[model samples]
Target: MVNVIIRSNEANAAATALTLAARDHHVCLLSDKVSPGLYQFSYFGEPRNEVLRAVDELKAGAPVIGVVFAEGEDVQAGMQDVLRVASPQLMVIVGGGITGAVEAAEAARRFGLDTSSVLQIGAFLFGGNLSSVRAEKHDVLAGFLGPETPDHLVELALATFPRLSLGNPAAVALSSINALFHVPPMLLNAMSVERAESIRFYVEGFGDSVCRLLLELDADRLRLGAALGLGLVPVQELKARYSGPDAPKGLSLREQVNTLSSQTAALPSSFHHRFLRHELRSSFAPMAALAAAVRVDVPTISSILRLSEILLEEDILDHAARPAQDFLNLMNTHSLSIN
Candidate 1:
């Protein structure tokens, strides 16, 4: 049986769900510890050097197949390093932060191992009164399948910027492209000041991290624009789900709403682009990337979320919401099913 480890602040809930699911598969608890062996590890909260050490220990005992970060970033580099150098079958899933995932993906690609998967489950909108308490948050996870994250992610970067290079352009483009994974839902949340502020700090951190990464690469103006152009990838996915399959419909989940709020603030022009339909075309790829992080709430995400409301002039909270896709690709879907 394949060993499975699940970790999260919401551990009880995840454990409950996994217990039911594990009846059909071998599920091993990583939180308390039972044995030294190969396992599928999952957890949330801040990343720590100790966690990396524990992971190294596990690898020392047996091969690790996949890892799920519930909510953290501390040991990201260490985790990525190990995934690159030691285990090729490792997979990682994180919440909705772009910086860590980007670095991980780049590291994995550089290592030449191409079978990793990342999943951005939901948005991290902090303020608005949301409908369902459970819906307000999500569990971010990762699974490793090889020396590096799947080559498909790199392909996605390329597809998002057919005209850009794999070097500087990829760095900026990937940053923009990954940014959207965190915005749309947060806009709809509009919960409260404390919550918004909390999420804002995270957003700022992620944005700064991406910007810093680009600066390190010496990314130029055009590269940034190309990255911005990549931002639309996640927005379009949001549009397809809530806005409408074809006509850019109104928001759809009023029934599921637990709370509601209204805001009348005007944002800077640069920030306003997330809501504009035309701008969506420009942000094509970055949006998907932002969603693929360690945590899901942030400010750039709020800007995008706010834009949707501004452009549509409609309350997204008062509509029928559909189920969002669970995985980005079928391979990811299947990987989730593996014992």
Candidate 2:
């Protein structure tokens, strides 16, 4: 029996399940074994049915684990529904940025979830999607957040990926390279975005200048972690950890971008894509708030949040209340472990 049943609306995160299901194959097709039309949410489309706009049912062991992987906004809005249906032994939010992870963890806390059993773990790994990044080429760095974590749960989580479990979920979230890789390209290449130009984002937009911006953003997150007494992973370090065997060590941000071109060749047609929408709120805004609470100013993060706010037409910080002191404390707690 499957120890946990992972669920997701995002193709990449949901692909985590597919990777597990098709463990032996380099590539797995849903149609190869299962009828997509019958089991999935054809109501939306195959891409989303994998996780979102619908769900799959199973009469497995009662009180099973449930994992949600989708856009942060969607996860934030639909977590209640997920809980009602899954009533899982464990609830894992797979793709929500640091903010979503914290928010979901708080919600679970408020609901009086027993961390020992019905635990909620907010985690996001860079490459869980086998479709986008092959298991061989892909890199995994999963960070988890929740109280009283059990070794069995950690093992169960590791069973889902082929990488080590990075400690302290908050540190993992703050160290996410997604925001560093995405926000800069969106703002710097706003013109191409406006034109809806079908150019490669990383290769074209991820120039030396953009890479510098990415480093600066990463620096802010690292600073926030430092202020909280946690030392987050540096971008180059994460890149090396997750990089394929052929990948070179000590790559600069630009070199890393070039190395990742194969995975990031698919670019969004508009700035209205998730890179801006998801990362800005999930990673940037939350980091900014934490930076404020810890008194570590993140001018770059702040500027991007503001720019995306104007572009997305919303005050991203308003999504969550004042940065919870506990938030900084959590980071502090993890920082101590890493220190």
Candidate 3:
């Protein structure tokens, strides 16, 4: 059995830990404040129960499934702790945009971990709450952070996530759809969000104009991907793919998104929500920086960032500078052409 260390006890992380545990892997979930012990976790939609054990409870000598998915510092710290405690067979950074992936890479480098053992996924494969997670079954794009990741590691990752597809790390990172999907809606619906109006984020917030702008931003992302010689899928197509068998087809991108996202969330009550913070800071800003580095003009992305900064009262691009540079450095190391 593989001993897996997952960072954060958040919905996604908890659900992932439970999924792995069900697969007979001894899963240990890490949270900064949560105590170490076995906790009863229930799965909804399909009503089931699973036990999530603490990190301290992992048995010695078990093969480690070192896949981690968490926010910025949390992921780095979790990687450090896992490296210190276990002889991880593989280190997977599930999803945190390019920034989070770079942070994981840096952590692995600091520990002198083999670059081949480090993997970066473009996004999470599951979606749901802390109590339960439904596998979205999206085509998960991933790649090694360095020059070469082993075939066995690839097999293990695919075994863990059957939908996972190996690809360029930069392409995988750039495939993130959050910035293209979330930012425009949030920006357009700012006042409603601030007012705490109970509105369906995808349905009500996404008007024709907002959808048009979203497409423009997506075009920029695609161009950036092309500049790096990676063919990133459009956000609409990605969303449709994630929607599974019953996914609507031939609809406008907006219609497809609104229709497929039957589980649309309510607009956040404040601009302080991670919808803005994560998508803008971690996703969009870094993409903008990459665009600048490659001489790709992403005017729409830039405008969104500027507007988000004005709304949030801080510099989004500046906040993302370090991660953007780290991403560029990683791409350069891979010898990818910028021209």
Candidate 4:
């Protein structure tokens, strides 16, 4: 049996890991704060612990691999503990942003593990109650650096998620679409979001004007991808592919919303969300830095960063600067996979 250990922060990431477990694969889910067994409180704070108990009870034949990390525990470091328990023949999956991926890969190398043993992967992990994985084909990216690559691990990942393997570390890092999804909606619909009404951010909320802004940011993303020799697809195209043509099709980002999304109007949510904290930092910061490096102007991304500065109430770009420098150091040091 190909044992798999998924180190994740968001419960949805752990929940996604359980899909493999349901298929009779040995899966271990490590996370911070939240218990792995799933005890969710309702919107009105009503109890739903019975489902959790039932799940645990039935998990005897298919035991639920639930692990709750200590306060302030690092997800990647948790892998070391799992390594001692289950020497997974498949791989240990590290899910995070570009900087996180680099650090995880570096940590694995420090642990004396090879490429065949681990594959670092992540995407737009929208956190809190909003977290979800698309049933449609979405763009998730993967990266590894070594002389001898593991072919089977990549295959396993493809079998698991709708992922595209970007052979270059830089390519994989640059391909994150979280900022594109999060920043635009948060900014454009700030008033509506602040009102605390349900806004179908992707489906109904992303009107023409918002999409235009996203497209502007996307132009720079594509440019950055081109500079690094990576063929990156825009969020609009990714959504179109995921939703299928039968849904709806439009010429531009605004137009595509009518056709590309399955949701007409979504449940109400708040402006106080992870979009600014996680998506902006992970997705936009790196691109803005790279655009400067390549001499490519990215006004939209820069503008979003400034707005994010207001929302986050801190100088956030400074946080990503060190990682960008560290990434530059890693570029020359590690091995690149050709596949």
Candidate 5:
């Protein structure tokens, strides 16, 4: 049996992995909170350096096959240090939020270490709410989306890993801001879930960059969604208005709706049907609107943010928004078209 160490600040991160490890292998979890068990380690959120030292001591007598870092920052630094000091048999698995996973994966690649990220996006999109949404090729499609690496590093961590149970800090921040666009006016007036899900399918179908941004901001996004429940403002008032060099002169929040509406007219009529008609009134649109608003400074996200509102009305900025474009370029698939 391979010995595995599951590490993270998020309670569920360790808990979820521990559950899986205990059921599958001779796995043990090291966490900041929770109880000791046949396969658990209780901790107080120790520093990365201290964690590294502990791993070193543990490896002296026994073989540690894999190290799974599930939460906190400085993940790249921590993983790298451990990789350098730990026994050569160690394989690292990073299962944190976007930044932590991205940074750790990149660092592992730099040192030529074996690693992968496990998000349940594919599973949830294809598996969850099956009765609510009809999809035929769900499992096959879900398993297809993987990391975007040219070096050919990513392999299946598992066919299905548990979904991220609690929101990570970065996810919380991104999601919070993305929720502003879905406020009252939009919800009470023109919301349409079908269209919103359609747009969501489109964007998430694109790839990692958009999805990473969404996951990193999930908590904040949901919080912003709750704000709309309070009935604070009109939906039209929540539209994003850009002020960058590409934006028309003197645009501000007050003039957001009118300016954005007029700009929508200039887009291809196909856009109105694919997005605007459907998303503009859905819960998803508002979320997309928030992403557009917060990322008003970034033209790509801004455009996607606006387009998402047009498509689903919700900010379905997760992996489905623009799957083919974002990580498709990096993936090794024949269907790498930027659709």
Candidate 6:
């Protein structure tokens, strides 16, 4: 069994730790907020017991799975903490936004860590919250931020996640399904967010208008990807791929999204919610920056970014521009072959 160190918080992190523990891996769950000790948590309503330990409790060289969902400074802080503690043989970044992963890789460099050992999953592998989790049967994209190589780290990652497949990190980042799926619904339902109404995020929120906007944004995303010489799977295709065998056949984007019965359907109470703030700042803003660099016009995406900035009363696009440029520079320096 792998001696795993899981840096966790929020539903995805908790659920990931629980899933690993259930699989008989020696999972040492580390959290800044959760108190250190043995804890019993449920997985899909079944009682499962696992220990939630502190980072310092980690062995000198265990593999760490960083289930960081936070963006910006939080991503840097969390990743630095993990590197400081275990100096892990392999560090897997799961569920963080595209820019969050870039921030994490930079943090590793600051610590003199071998960035080639860092692997990032394009999305979270599960579909539920901390109270319970249901494993997603879809394949996930993962790749090193640094130069590609065959190593024990890759083997360990593959063993841990059987559905994982290696791909170009740039493609993986640009292929972020969250930017396509989460942003439009949140933008269209601004009044609901302002009112703090508790509507189902997908089932009730993904109306015809939202789907139309999502399609337009997704088309621009594809264009951006093509400009960068990357083949991006359309958002509808991605949803179908992730939804696995139960996905309805030949459904439109709206029909497919609205029919996702297993989705955790709670709308964010305010604009500050990660669905809005994080997606715009960490996901779409960076995409917009990259699109601009390549002289691609992503009008729908541009519109959403402007609307989000107006709603949030901040300039997210400008904030993301420098970092996005830096990310492209890093990819070039490492010979990651973006084009």
RMSD to native for every prediction? 16.1, 6.0, 2.4, 6.3, 18.6, 2.5
Candidate order by lDDT, decreasing, is 3, 6, 2, 4, 5, 1
Model 1 misplaced stretches (Cα beyond 4 Å): 6-20, 32-64, 73-88, 106-231, 234-339
TM-scores for candidates 1 onward, in order: 0.34, 0.76, 0.90, 0.72, 0.34, 0.90
lDDT of 3 by residue, 1-339 (tens): 677887665666666777777667788777664554554554436666556666667878766777676443367777887766677888888777777778877888888887778888776666665556665656777888888677888787777767777888888777776656777888999899888998888888888888999889889899888887777888877766666667766688777667643346787887767677777777789988888877989999899889888889887888777898898888887888766
* Clash pairs detected, candidate 6: none
The positional error of residue 65 in candidate 3, measured at the CA in angstroms, is: 1.7
For residues 1-339, write the lDDT of model 6, one tens digit per residue. 566666656666667766766776666666655555665666766786666555555444455554444432376666666655565667777755568667767877887767687777887777665556665648787778788645777887788887786877777777777767888889999999899887999978888999899889889989988887778888877777777887888877788787785545788888878788887877788888988888999998899999998999988887888768877875675664454
Candidate 2 clashing pairs?
8-51, 9-52, 144-169, 230-335
lDDT of each: 0.31, 0.58, 0.76, 0.54, 0.33, 0.74
Task: Please provide, for model 4 over 103-164, each residue's C-alpha lDDT reduced to its tens digit, 9 standing for 90 to 100.
Answer: 55566667676744455544532222312323333345556544345666556555554344
- For model 5, the superposed segments whose C-alpha errors exceed 4 Å read 32-72, 81-101, 114-329, 332-335
lDDT of 2 by residue, 6-41 (tens): 444455544455444334212112212233322232
- As a TM-score, model 5 comes out at 0.34
Q: Which 10 consecutive positions of candidate 5 have the poorest summed lDDT?
A: 122-131
Better of 2 and 4 by lDDT: 2
4 against 6, candidate with superior TM-score? 6
Q: In terms of lDDT, which candidate is strongest?
A: 3
